[model samples]
Target: MATRIAPHEMPMIGRRELVCLIALMMSLSAMAIDGMLPALDEMARELGAANGNQRQLVVAVFLLANGVGTLFPGSLADRYGRRPVLLGTLAAFAACSIAVALVHSFEALLVIRALQGFSAAGLMVVPYAIIRDQFEGDAMARLMSLVGAVFIVVPVVAPSIGQGVLLIAGWRWIFLSLAGVSAIGALWLWLRLPETLHPEYRHEINVPIILRNMGAAFFNRAAVGYVLGTSLLIGAVFGYVNSAQQLIGEHFGAGTWFPVVFGATAAMMVLSNIVNSRIVETFGARRVSHAGVLLFMLVSMVQVWASYAHPGELAWFLPLMAANLGLLGFLGANFGSIAMQPFAHIAGAASSIQSFFRMFGAAVVGLVIGQAYDGTARPFAFALLICSVLALALVLFSEKGRLFRRLNGPVRQEAE
Candidate 1:
């Protein structure tokens, strides 16, 4: 188990309502990315994009900017407060979405997308620090799992939503819809969510202090190791998402059935998160995630063998792939809660620094995994095994040769 903070006053809303609201706020980024996918070709054609690769940069630039921009909000929130940063981010996101719909040139569109992505970073980073403020240990993991279970449904349904919009209206309506949704989310936050950060934890926004506290977070052995390890696991998951269409549609010949197959595999993840929330408290986070890694490695071995022996049918491949995705529910949130255990005092700065690394590092690793795909699933299968193995090693390092052990409370904070 990870360390727990002393009980702070609870929010006005109930636990389930807070989880739903947090999940909705976080879902904006996913909806922006996934829902716009079906309109890429049309966007490229209308805006006179130079080539297919350049057209794809609409999504790519936003992701790059989002990762880089994660460095700001949590640190800013550390000084200003969570409510203001969150509200400003939601407003900025809505403005950017509306701006994207009005852009006439490809260059302009990419620029707006990058800005939108940077703004969307707060929707993710602040919520993490918020949840950290309210809960820790298995309770934090449980909250994260439930939040994830809700947030994840966006990806499963977003493309279909986009496609439906395109069938009846112009591609720009997708952005308009995004704008409407974020505005509603902003309104909800303004009305209901209370400022959760403790006043004693608040401090100056000076760069030296921010840097110093972030250094304290990273220098802690248990915290930094789990952060890096979780990023490696995230890379493996992102790599699968990057290549899913090619693997499921082309290699397995799913054709028009691709969405159904993808949705089914993703649905398993939702189920696993639900299961994880139910059991993480009983088994403990470390034990649960370690078991997940072991099982993931086993499934990857079968995948590697199967890919090499036969190209495989959809029936054979889908279930194995689903099992791998499902296991992440056991790993991601638990690992995140564990990583944050040592940094309650500097939660914002530490969260910003760690999130920046996770976003940037996972994207780089995932790009390598996706670009290495060679028609067959051999590259992807090997990537799964390699990433999982390395992640396990990192976890072992963090645990200092221990596994399945529980610590009673947060690590003692080092001197500033």
Candidate 2:
């Protein structure tokens, strides 16, 4: 008998189109979070937000929900395929957008936003599994870096877009705009994207299977260590997200200029991704990520000392902070690609476990750092320092005390 390839085991899709579709899908979550930054004060005022610090909850709860919801989407994608699950999640995301816009109370918006986060989880996670389905190793790392390069642009501009909407209308218009974007993305995806999961690779959706696969992923030293490292560093990312408005707008009195300041700072991530895309194929994901984390930790320590010395000074804070954040762009994609490298056959399940650890841990860390906000930047600087150091240790541990070495181990290689 002749061998047979499944329907999903075809040639790779057009790289340009696939990258765009995946980037758009990923941006849905970024838009939901970053776009709301410029409107937090207005949201707080109208929604009866309890206090200044409490306004950060608007982002925190959504992130927490997104992380929690990620626990399921990958397993579901593994069973049912990525396309149908992705489309359904997009619909849910769009629905939540409209619901959030229509809600009369802050509590109602938070509830709907949590649902929105759940939907965003599919957008954030499934695409990575899909990419894993198509590529592996150095190629996969390079492709992911390209995706991250494009994905970082959303954060650079989403706040400005939100601020622009606020100028023409109310904060509710932002959610309405998100609904429109989500609907458009869903339509584009429905038309263009195909199911990437090969039928032969599909797994049954049962609790025991899930637990077993998750256990396999957890037991992989490299995967778990990178995940833990990524988890801690993510606190720095979310801490910034949770406090950027206050740090730049209120503390620095940038106010109306918040978007410009935020966008400029975020542009560092775009630059970092562009550089990583170019260099990652040569340096290898582990080396680049290793160096990036160490640099981030060093910069973080400097920032902590500076923040304490010149408290509330945006002049000293913004540029140094931007440098610290740019390094993150290099770290995130590399770490994730390295972690997923070992689990191609079960990319969906592996991705779920990794995302659960990174995102959920990040949510907890972000909430704590955000809630600890004082009238100064010291808390955030301190939090970043702690997280960065811990992250470095975890990454080193994951590499089995080896840094800047090319890793060779049992790596899965299979047909798409």
By lDDT, who's the top model here? 2
Candidate 1 per-residue lDDT, tens place, 1-416, comes to 44345535667877888989999999999889878766776898999998544554676667768788889998899889898999999999999999999999999998999999899999888999998887778888888999999988887888778878987997899999999999899888889888888888887878888888888876678877778877787777667666665677678887656667877887788899999999988888888998998898899899888887777577667888889889988998888888877677788887888887777677677767766766778888898899888888888988997888877665565424
Would you estimate the TM-scores of all the predictions?
0.93, 0.96
Candidate 1 runs further than 4 Å off: 1-10, 48-56, 414-416
Q: Residue 89 in model 1: shift from native, Å?
A: 0.7
lDDT of 2 by residue, 1-416 (tens): 01122445564457878888899889989999999899999989998988898889889989999999888889999999998999999889988998988888888878888888877898888999988888777677878888988998999999999999988998889998888988888888777777888888899878888878877876788777899888899877898899889988988889899999998888998899889988887888888999999999899989989987888788898898889879988999999988888787888888887898888889889999988888788889999899988988888788888899875555753212
TM-score of 1: 0.93
What's model 2's overall lDDT?
Answer: 0.86
**In TM-score terms, which candidate is top?**
2
Candidate 1: residue 376 Cα off by (Å): 3.3
